[model samples]
Target: MSEITPELVRHLGELARIRLDDDEVTRLTGQLDAIVDNIAKVSQVATPDVVATSHPIPLENVFRPDTVGEVLTTAQALQNAPDAAGDRFRVTAILGEEQ
Candidate 1:
């Protein structure tokens, strides 16, 4: 069994900026030591020949075929103009002069 003392628990709580009652610190210390021992047991396993895998399955791209359709005329493109002053589109006053 791992040794868990009240002084160790108080020190750990102070380091973490936590204020714990004596009873709570005593209980938490035992639990934390148990958890650490269990993790240490897990760390004792050997992995000499195992290859690391980042993801489970492979991926493939799914795409749709290209399409060609009818195009709009230039006159139809500039039909819904709020204010057009020339053969092209027009706008309001400019804030700064062109460079």
Candidate 2:
């Protein structure tokens, strides 16, 4: 089992800019020790032949094919615009630019 000493916790607290009281340090020591021990057990079970994976289940792309279909004409597209220019939608100038 990995030993989480008070000195180690204090050093970590300084690096993280945290001020841990004596009680907090003592509590974290036990919690951190358990976490390290669990990780060590997992490492032992992971052999060279076993493949590493980020997820337990397999994943595949579920997207539809990208194909052109019927499209609206320029007049049809601009029919519902509040303001329309010659062949496009018109809007008030932004960024104070001249027409």
Candidate 3:
């Protein structure tokens, strides 16, 4: 039998700052117990000879190799800027502090 009890559920609820009434506590106790039992069953079947996998079937990378492509020059980048200061774009200070 799973070790999940009503007291443990109530304690978890308190730790998470959640207020669980008696009805909710009772309901969650059974649900949590079932989940724990299922996990236990999986653990029993997960032997050293068994291989663990995220997916049942093998997956291959279907993406292109990461390589540098065309990039905009500084002048090309700042061409559409409404305001420019030196070689950078300028906007009004948001924090009301002088630069």
Candidate 4:
């Protein structure tokens, strides 16, 4: 016996606020039945002793350890700026405010 039927597909379409015509209902019924059969086949192999996993092989992090690195000083960083104000970059007011 098939697990999915045309009536069930039509009911599902109604629940999802979709209008399934007769042809769509007939096609979906067969596709859903095949999906159900595949799921059943997978369930049969998933025994208590078998472990479920997202991947077939083991995975490990490939990132290097986080550590502090050499960086430029404040004066060196602000040397190339067109304008500087007390160890900070200075820019013209952009919000139409009085400087």
Global lDDT of each model? 0.78, 0.91, 0.93, 0.94
Tens digits of per-residue lDDT for model 2, 3-46: 77888998999999999999999999888888888888899999
Kindly provide the TM-score of model 3 when superposed on the true structure, using C-alpha atoms.
Answer: 0.61
- Each candidate structure's TM-score, on Cα atoms with residue i matched to residue i, is 0.46, 0.57, 0.61, 0.61
lDDT of 1 at 24: 95
For residues 3-79, could you state the per-residue lDDT of candidate 1 as single tens digits?
Answer: 66778889989999999998898789889889888888767763657556676677778888878778767677678
Better of 1 and 2 by TM-score: 2
| Top lDDT prediction, candidate number | 4
Model 4 TM-score on a 0 to 1 scale: 0.61
Instruction: Give stretches of model 2 more than 4 Å off.
Output: 64-99
Candidate 3 has its poorest 10 consecutive residues by lDDT at 90-99
Candidate 1 vs 3: which has more TM-score: 3
Clashes of each: 0, 0, 0, 0
* lDDT score at residue 21, model 4, on the 0-100 scale: 91
Report per-prediction Cα RMSD to one decimal: 10.6, 6.6, 5.1, 7.8
Q: Tell me which of candidates 2 and 4 scores higher on TM-score.
A: 4
Model 1 misplaced regions, further than 4 Å: 1-3, 52-99
